[model samples]
Target: MKKILVPFCLFLVTLAYSQDDLLKSLDSTQTEESYSTATFKALQLVTLQTTKMPAKKEFYFVVSHRFGTVKDGFDSFFGLDNATTKLGGIYGVTDWLAVSLSRHTLNKMYETGLKYRVARQNDNFPLDIVGYSVADINTFLEKDQYPGLEFKHRMTYVQQVLLSRKISEKFSLELVPSFIHKNLYNPDIERDNQFSFGGGGRYKITKRLSVNLEYMHNFDKPDFYKNPLSVGLDVETGGHVFQLIFTNSQSMSESGYLTNASGDWGKGDFFFGFNLYRVF
Candidate 1:
C-alpha cells in the first residue's frame, strides 16, 4: 500500500499544476501545433493496461540489479556469486506492434523479442490484451557439444500472450498462456520442452499508477521444477514509465529468467529490480 500512496498523491498533484488546473483547462482553439500538442497531452493523461497506447514512436530502456545466486554456478560454486546488472530496450511501431532487444552484461547473452496487440482496435475494453513472442540465443554456451550435433545447439524460443480486462476503475486482471521450446536438450540434466501457463493482474490506486502480480506454472516435471511468482508496480509520468518490482527470480532474460527461475519466495530469496521506460 505504501507504493500506491505515492502515485495517488501525484495524481492529485497533477490536478493542480501551478494554478493552471490541467484537468479543467482546455484550449479549444485549433492549430497544427495545437492539435499535435493536444493529442500528446491527451495520451499522457490516461493510464493504459498495455503499454502500447498510440505514440509517434516509442522507445524504452530498462535496467535492473539482482541480489541473489546466479542460476548456472549455484551447484558448483556454493552460490556465492555477486549481484549482477542488466539492461533492456523496447521499440513501438504503429502502436499495434513493438519490438524489443535486451541483454545481461554479466554473461553477454542476448534476447530479441516482439509484442503485437492483435485486437486493440476495439474501443469498449482498453487493449483487450497483448501477445508477445521472444527468441533467445545463449551466446555464452558452447556452439557445439557432441560431434555432428551442431543443429541441436540452436536458440530457444518462447511465446506468450498477455490477456487483461479492467473489472473496475481500480481493478484489472490478466491471463498469460505461454509455450517454451529448446532445440538442444540434455537428458541427464532435466529440462522442459513443452507448453506452460501463467496469469497476472493489476490494481490501480490512481490514474497514473498500479500494482502488478503474475504467476507462471510449468506442467512438465514436479520434483526439480518450481513455479515463478512476481509482484511489481507501474508508474507513468509524461513520457517516462517506472517499474519498481520484487520477485524470486533473478535470471534477467525471458528464456533464462522466466523459465528457469529457481529461487523460492518463501525462502527469502526475492530481489528488487526496476524498469525505466522513455520515448523519443
Candidate 2:
C-alpha cells in the first residue's frame, strides 16, 4: 500500500504544479510581486525549512493521505484496518504568523488538533522559528460491548518550539523540541508522558524541487513507548508539492507520538508514507 500511495501522491503533486505553470503564463495581469510572498510561505510549510523565513498573507488548504503496515485484526483484513487519513488547513494570520488545524481518521477512533505560530521572522537572521502546540482527543470503544459503548474520550496535549535554520540558498535544517502528555488513554501504561527532540533537513534539487528528511527521538524509558524516527523527501514543481517518506513510527499526531507508538527503533517494522499538496 505504501509503495502504491507514494507514486500516486507524486503524480497528483506534479499535475497541480503543471496547472499552476499554465495559469502563470495565461494571466498576464497578475503581478509576480503579488504572488511571490504567499508562494514562498506555502513552500516553506511544505518544505519545513529551518531559517528565518517570510510568512504568507493568503489562506491555503492542504489535504494529506498516509498509509502504513497492518498492525492489528488480521482476520477482518490484513492491515486494511490500519490505514490513516488526515485533512487539514493552514492560514497566514499575518506576514509573520500562521495557524493550522487538522483532523485524522483512525479506523473507528477520530483525532483532531490545532497549531499556531507565536514567533515572527525575517530573512537576514535565517532562523525562522515558530512556537506551536496541539491538542487531540481519542475515544475508546470495544466491539464485544452492548450494541454501542459510551465513548470514553482520552485527551492529549503537545507543545513544541519549532526552529528552522537556512544553511545556504540550497540547504536548510529544522529542530523541534516538544513535550507531550496523555490521559485516560491507557491505564496500565503508567508512563504516558514524554519529551522529544526532532530534526529535519532539506536540499533543493532544483528551484521548484527539493529533498527533505526528518527524525524524532524520545527522552524516556524505552519500556513505556517505542521512540519513532522517520525520513521523507519533498518535490515542489510549481503550485503543488509531493512528499515521500518512510518511518518506524505509525502515530500521526502529537498525542499519538506520546502514547501510541508501538514500533521499536532498532527493529525493522517500518512502512512508507506520502503527502500530496496542491494550492488553488
Candidate 3:
C-alpha cells in the first residue's frame, strides 16, 4: 500500500497538468504536455522490466527460453541440451495497465502479474515510472520428498518499481527496485524476504537492432550464490521483437533469478537464451 500511494498521486498530478486548464486568465491558449512514446521498444530489457505498456486493447503472445549453463562445454552441448521454457500472454486492459499469465518449466511455476504506467515522461518531466507485481506458485515440490509440505509452502510474490529515461534517440536506461517474499525457503541458503536492485539499458546500433545489458544485486544474498549478469541484442521485426540473450542464470522468473542464480560468470557458467514476442 505504501508503494501504491506515491505513484497513484503522481499519476493524478501528471494527468491534471497534461490538460488545458480553463483558468486561462493571462494566456489565451495553454500548451498540453504530451506523453513520451517508445522510451523502450519492449516491456522487458534483458532480465529487468521496463517502463513500457501495451496500448489499450492490444494483445501479445510471449515465448521465452533459457538454456543450461554453458560451462559444461560439449558434454552438455553448451547449454542447448538442457533448456527451460516459458509461455505467456499479455493483454492491455487500458492504456495505463496490462495483465499477464505465464507458465514456466522450472519448478513448474505458474505466474500472474500486472504492469501499469503510473507516470510518463513528458515535457519538463524527466522520468517514466511504472509499477509491476506478480505472484507465483511452485508446483514441482513433492509431498513424498518432504512429508511436511503444505499448500502455502509453494507461494512466492514479487513487486517492483520500474523507472526509466530516454536520454537520446539512441539510448535509454532503467533502474528497478524489487521486493520478493516466499512462504517457504531454506533459512541457510536465502532469506524468506529479499530485496534487489537492477540496472539495465539499451543502445541502438542500428534502426532494427540494439544492445542491451542488465545486472542485479541482491542485498541479502549468501556468498555462494552469485549475482546475475546478462547481455543481449534486441532485434525488432515488423510486428514482433526478438531478443538474443546471454546470462549467468537459467531461471527467467523474477524470484528465481534474483535469489537462486547459481552460475558464475567468472567460470563461464552462463546460459544462452532468447525471448520472442508477437503483438496484435
Better of 1 and 2 by lDDT: 1
Candidate 3 yields a Cα-based lDDT of 0.87
Model 2: lDDT of residue 12: 41
Question: lDDT by residue for model 1 over 80-172, one digit each (tens)?
Answer: 356666677777776677777878765566779878765431222233456778887766665455554563465888887665555566765
The prediction achieving the highest lDDT against the true structure is 3
| Candidate 2 lDDT by residue in tens digits, 185-245 | 3445445666666677777777766666666666653574666666666676577667775
- Candidate 3: pairs in clash: none
Worst 10 residues of 3 by lDDT: 22-31
Give the root-mean-square deviation of each candidate in angstroms: 11.9, 12.8, 5.0
The estimated TM-scores of all candidates read 0.70, 0.67, 0.88
Q: What global local distance difference test value does model 2 have?
A: 0.54
- What lDDT does the true structure give each of the candidates? 0.58, 0.54, 0.87
Which sections of candidate 1 miss by over 4 Å?
1-56, 69-81, 121-127, 143-154, 189-192
Model 2 bad stretches (over 4 Å) = 1-57, 70-82, 107-126, 140-153, 190-192, 221-224, 264-267
Question: How would you order the candidates by TM-score, starting with the best?
Answer: 3, 1, 2
